[model samples]
Target chain A: MKINLALAQINTKLGDVEANLAKHLEYIEKAKAEKTDLLVFPELSLTGYVLQDLVASVAHKPVEDDPVFKHILAASRDLDLVVGFVDEDSRHRFYIASAYLSGGKLVHVHHKVYLPTYGLFDEGRFFAWGDAVRAFDTRFGRVGMLICEDFWHASPPYLLWLDGADIMLFSSASPGRGLNDKEKLESARWVERVTKAYASMFTSFVVHSNRVGYEDGLHFWGGATAFDPNGEELAHGPYNEEAITYTQLDLNQLRRTRARLPLLRDERTALVQKELDRILNRG
Target chain B: MADINLTLNTDLARDILSGFIKSEITRVGLSRAVIGLSGGLDSALSCALAVAALGRENVLAVRMPYKASSKDSLDHAQLLIDQLDIPNKTIEITDMVEPLFQLDPDISNMRKGNIMARERMIVLYDQSEVFKGLVVGTSNKTEILLGYSTLYGDSASAMNPIGDLYKTQVRQLSRAMNIPAPIIDKPPSADLWADQTDEKELGFTYEEADKLLYLLVDQRYSPQEAVEAGFNKKFVDTVTTRIRRNQFKRMQPPIAKVSNRTIGYDFLYLRDWGT
Candidate 1:
């Protein structure tokens, strides 16, 4: 099966949900025009990232009940969307969350795990950690979803791979940092290393969408990318600008890679299960 | 693996900062700036950036020298003024502050230094109105975190062009911009009292503090992690404590929250939308 995916790298304003929803709709239409099946936006695309205390003002339920969700549902009849927003539950607990909307409804919702409280990240101050990572059936294949810091811990991807994932999507609001003497974006350079390695390690396709623009002085460099099961980059987007990159993925490659490596065929689940039980018991 | 180096692309950094100055000021519907030129590297760099952004015509460099301030301070400031081709003024602050010092007759040097620092601010802000320009701040991230500066004194300004840069980074950029060697090389002094260099007063050199700070703040290492990374335990603890203790100086006076939308909390909006 062949799946056409579009990565929407956009600059989101802090605490401007309506304006952000408008940008999302515009990109959704553009992706539909390109005949893309799924469109993905960066982390917190519904409300700009690093919003400190502004998260309280913009937090809301998933697209189902959100006032902005109606417009998104109307636009999604032709395409699927993976967008990020600060989610609030019935009890008013806030979470850094993302949703996969298809055919005018939310197909799946994934709350972010590993809220980073260190260095440039303060998600712990504003969000509750998500508890599980699992893959669900999409029209294309079994797909897994993970937010920015979730990708940092190899366990999430490992669990999703064990659960049989053919495609994985990652949303990020990473700031542009560590420029080199040649004026290259150093953070993107490092991100490329991890994305490529993860694709090869899991033998699954990976799509990463990062945001762009500046808030106060912190800059977000959008270097959105996607990699095939063989760890080869299929497409790349522009840095420091709003861009949409389209790439076609062949699901057959996943079968070939898994057959060749036989990584999943090897028996390690029992050992992992035992170790996790032992570790948790100790805790 | 332990080393990290990020010397900014000097030309690009200069262009970016100058652009920021232009946009931020013009966004508020003003095009002119008033800077306190202290004949030191920080103020000199600030002056140079303002000149590049607003043009030499729109910048006013005022030198307010205290009684014990070195003659070289005035000369170095003049050198910058001549080089940048900006209008300059000299205001002696001794006459204005001596009366306050005499009232106590035997006040501590720390108290007297603070009086001078604040007195300088008063004159600078007055000139800001007469010149129809905003007072540009020169506080770098190092002094700001350390609380080495007197609050509402040298720290007062409408906006800051170099507040994010570390002292070490400031030195690099100043050198890249060709700041005078004397001002850049000489020991950093607030010139509150004679021989009162910043490093001496803080009991640590900027080169030393910058390395630890680069590890702590920029690299985001925990206090123990910093010590493990080869920094002195006491130094790391002292510097980090000062940063935490002085956090109040970093922000505006915090307001009580009783309403649904407070000014700084839920209502934090960009400058583009004016109240």
Candidate 2:
């Protein structure tokens, strides 16, 4: 199977979810015009990152019954979309989440498992942690979703591959920090290294979508990128610009690599399960 | 070809900074600005950025010189005013601070400098009410991190434009803004005491400090790692220690966290208070 995916690296204002939803509608129309099958955006693309108290006002559930989401749901019928928004539960507890919409329905919702709360980030104070990681099938292929900081750890992507995902997509709102020899921002280079290594190790296609623009003192560099199953870069977008990069992912390449490596197939699940049980019980 | 040459696109920088100044000032219900013009690169860059944002007619550049301040300082400041054609005033702070300094005749030059800084801020803020403008700050990221500024003194301002850029970066930006070449090339000084240069007292050049700071702070390299990256161990240790010790100046007065939400602790966030 071949699928054309669009990476929407956009600039989002803090705590303006209504305007942000409007932006989503416009991007959906553009993606549809480009004849793209799936479109992915950065983490917290609707509300923006570094929203300490503003998150409370902007947080909302992507419920189908709501007219706000109905506009997006109507637009997603022709073009599937993965968008980031602050997911407020019925009890009003919030989690940073991404919604996968296809066939005019919210197909799957992935809550961000990792909430960074260190220097330049205070997400732990504002959000409740998510508790699940698994892969499910799409019309294109079996897919997995990861949020910003979750992929920093090797376990999340490892679990995704173990759960039979051939395609992986990540939503991020990473800030640009430091500069390399050519005076380029450093974060995107490290992310590219991670993307290639993950794709090659798992023999799966990977897509990373990021946000851009200035929010207060923080600058987000929108260098969204994608890799094929063989770990080669398929498409790359520019930095610090609102860019839409479209690329095709070939599912046949994943089949070819998995057949050659057989790393996932020849695995001992029982031994790993026993270790995990012992580790959890003792902890 | 240095270890980290951070040269910004001046045109882009100017636009981003002017936009930031406009938004920040207008959000606070003000269109004008007041700056403590010290004839230094940091102040010059801040003044230039303010003019770009709020025009020359709206910016009030107050030159507060002390009894021991250099004549060159006044001349350099006037050069900028003549070039920008902005309204400026030279206020002598000798009478304001001399009364306190006289009480303790044995006070160190550093103490005297602190007195001068605080007194200048008082004059600027009072003028802020009169001029109907915010006090745009001139303290750069280097001085701020190293705590080379006096608290509640020159550090107090309604907003700061150059606080993120290092001292070296400030010079580059000043050149980008077409500031006078002599002002950019002059040895840095607070002009608190005669013949007092900033680097001579600090025991380090800003070029050395900027390079090490770029690695240790911005790049997140350990002090030992910075030494490995070709910086001196003494310089790395000194820079890192100052950054850690001087972190208090970066934040507001610490409130005792008694409740779940305390102002300046858990509440009164920047976005909540301003934009």
Candidate 3:
């Protein structure tokens, strides 16, 4: 099957949900015009990142009746949409989350399991830890979502792959840091390498959408990118600028690559699980 | 010991810094910037960047020269103003600061210099209000790290574009941006007194200091480790001591924790909150 995806690399106002909602609607309309099958926004697309004390105020439940999700769900009737926001549970605990809405229904909600607290990030100080990493059925295929730091660790995406996800949608509000001789940011280059490696290793399509513009002193280099199951870069957005990049993803590439490699088919989950159990419970 | 590479991709740096200046200023409902140009490299680069971000018409460069400030200082500033074609004002601060100087007949050079800097800051802020612009700062990373600036004087600003660039890095970028040759090549100075130059006052060249600082601060080297990295042990000790001693100049006044969430301690929110 072939799927059309739109990676929206946008600039968001810090802690302003209303203005961000308008921007999402505008991007959805543009994606629809381009006949996109799925539209993905960067992490914290609804409420901006760096919301230390303001996280609770911007948090919302991604239910059908939610003031923000209602418009998003309505837009999903035309095409599937993935958006990032602060998710509040029944007990008022907040998580950095992404929700996938398709056919006017919330299909999957992924709470970011890893909140990086080191070196310029303060997500752990304000957000509750997420304990789930599961893939769900989407209109395109079985897909999983991971926000920023979650994908930085290999375990989450590996678990998603084991759970039968053929597509991995990774989003980030990654700030630009470290300059290289090639004029590319160190952070941007590292992300591109990781996403492509994951694509080739897991034999799945990987799509990454990163936000652009500045918040406080942190500059987020946009540079949204995609890789096929063959680990070939299919599309790349501009660096340090806002843009929407669209690419046609052929899901059949997964079948061709996996048939050749056969790494997933030869997996031994039981032995791996037993080893992990022994390592954790070692005397 | 390996050499620390401080070279920046001027194109990328220009794009990022200009975007930063534009976003930080406009997010607060202001579209213009008012910068105090010292006819030195740092201020010249800051003014050029502000013009790039907010346009030449939006940035107002103000030259606040003291009586003892060099004639070349004013002329160099005028050359930048003419080159960038930005709006400018030359405000002589001699008369404004005379009352305080006259009050102290035995005033020290440091006190007089502080008075000149604070008076220039006053002029900048007042012109910022008149021009509906925010004050932009020009202190580079080297001086900021060494506490080479007077607190609340030249250090005060609504935002700073070049604060993170070290002195040598600032010169590299300034040359790339095509700042006037005289401004970029001349010996760095505060021009606070008749013969005041930064290196002569600090007793060290910015080149040597930048390398040692990169090892100590950026590379997180200890004083012993820096000495092992080919730096003199005394240089490392002096720089580290100065950095520690000037910690107060870098931070907000601490508030006592009286509530469940104290400001800057627990009640944390970014400066771009709600904007």
lDDT of 1 by residue, B1-275 (tens): 24646466676567656766765577568899999999998999998899888999999999999888988899999999988889889999999999999999779999988898899899999998989888988999899989888889999988787887788888888999988888899888988877778988888998778778878887888989988888888998889999999998888898899998898776654553320
Better of 2 and 3 by DockQ: 3
Q: Write the per-residue lDDT of candidate 3 for residues A1-283, one digit (tens) a residue.
A: 9999999999998889999999999999999999999999999999988898999899988887899889999999999999999999999889999999999999999999999999899888899999999999987879999999998999998999999999999999999988635568888889999999999989889999999989888999999999998899999999888788999999999989998988799889999999999999997
User: Global lDDT of each model?
Assistant: 0.84, 0.84, 0.92
* Location of the lowest summed lDDT over 10 successive residues in candidate 3 chain B: B1-10
What are the per-residue Cα lDDT tens digits for candidate 1 across A43-63?
A: 999998877667778887765
Q: Quick one: ranking by TM-score, best first?
A: 3, 2, 1
Which stretches in model 3 have alpha-carbon errors above 4 Å?
none
Could you give candidate 2's per-residue lDDT for residues B46-131 as a string of tens digits?
Answer: 99999999999999999999878999999999999999999888899999999999999799998998999999999999999999
Where in model 2 is the C-alpha error above 4 Å? A180-182, A250-283, B1-36, B47-68, B77-135, B164-181, B203-248, B256-260, B272-275
Candidate 3 residue pairs in backbone clash: none
Interface RMSD of 3: 1.2
How far out, in Å, is residue A280 in model 1?
3.7
Model 3 lDDT per residue over B1-275, tens place:
65788888888888888899999999999999999998999999999999999999999999998888999999999989999999999899999999999998999999998889999999999999999999989999999999999898999998898988899989998998989999998999999888898999998999999999988888888899899989887888889999999999999998988888788898888899888
TM-score of each: 0.77, 0.79, 0.98
Residue A47's C-alpha lDDT in candidate 2? 84
